[model samples]
Target: MKQSRLMSLVESVANVIVGYGVAVVTQILIFPVFGLHTTLAQNLKMGAIFTIVSIARSFALRRVFEAIRMRSAK
Candidate 1:
């Protein structure tokens, strides 16, 4: 129980950090090249989008990690 709670907290923090990173990356690498406005509103919108994407990415990565571990054990 305690271990699960700690794991949950770690996962939550990782998601937020990854979301912010993705948002910043989009702003720097993708937005400017495409001429998208980097205003506060746009940034907020992008951040929200990134938060969702990051969560999905995290879950996908977790699955891949599990798969790799399983394959290595076998």
Candidate 2:
């Protein structure tokens, strides 16, 4: 049970980080279509800020759901 919980936590974190990477990559690739040009550094900096926000939001929501699940399990 403990191992499963830990494994899930690790997976959740990994998934969030990977999702952030994908989002950033997609944003960089598609931005030019809109005539929004930025240097690589600028794009990366923007991506980093949004990624951190996403990770925090994801983790917080995940914990809230887990708490509610555990509560109902009893």
Candidate 3:
């Protein structure tokens, strides 16, 4: 079955929300290993920025793949 645009967006957002948390936590753990230190607020801000970009990329890719699936189905 084909996925609706709204569902695609919802899925992307949900995925990114989980990823945002993971990214922040990972930064907290991993940054020190590389000698990169940042405050909690800074990490959160960076995570938010990356989350927005990730959401956009995920949604766009989903749409592109859906389009391809639709074309191939015809």
Candidate 4:
């Protein structure tokens, strides 16, 4: 089944949100293993920065793949 552009965008955004949540949760769980103790606010700040970077990376790669797909389709 093929999805429309809007659907693809929605899926991409949802993926980013899910990925961010998983990453943030993992970071909090593993922070103690690295002997770094942090407050909730601090962890959230760090997570936000990482999430932004991840979103950019994901979007860039998605665009690249989509372009390739378009070229192949034609």
Tens-digit lDDT track of model 4 for 1-74 = 34556666677778878987887788889998999898878888888898778767776777778778888888
Per-residue alpha-carbon lDDT of model 3 for 30-64, expressed as tens digits?
99999999999999999999999999999999999
Return whichever of 2 and 3 wins on lDDT.
Answer: 3
In candidate 3, the residue pairs with backbone N, CA or C atoms under 3 Å apart (3 or more residues apart, or in different chains) clash, namely none
lDDT per residue for candidate 2 within 2-37, as digits (tens), equals 235565567667887787678778888999999988
- Ranking 2 against 4 by TM-score, winner: 4
lDDT of 1 by residue, 1-74 (tens): 12243464468568777668767766866777887757767777778787777766766666667667768878
Relative to the true structure, candidate 1 reaches a TM of 0.54
Candidate 1 lDDT score at position 2: 24
Predict model 1's lDDT versus the native: 0.68
Clashes of each: 0, 0, 0, 0
Who is ahead in lDDT, 1 or 3?
Answer: 3
Give the range where candidate 4 is weakest over 10 consecutive residues by summed lDDT.
Answer: 1-10
Which ten residues in a row are the worst by lDDT in model 3? Answer: 28-37
Candidate 1's error at 20, in angstroms? Answer: 0.9
User: Ranking under TM-score, best-scoring first?
Assistant: 3, 4, 2, 1
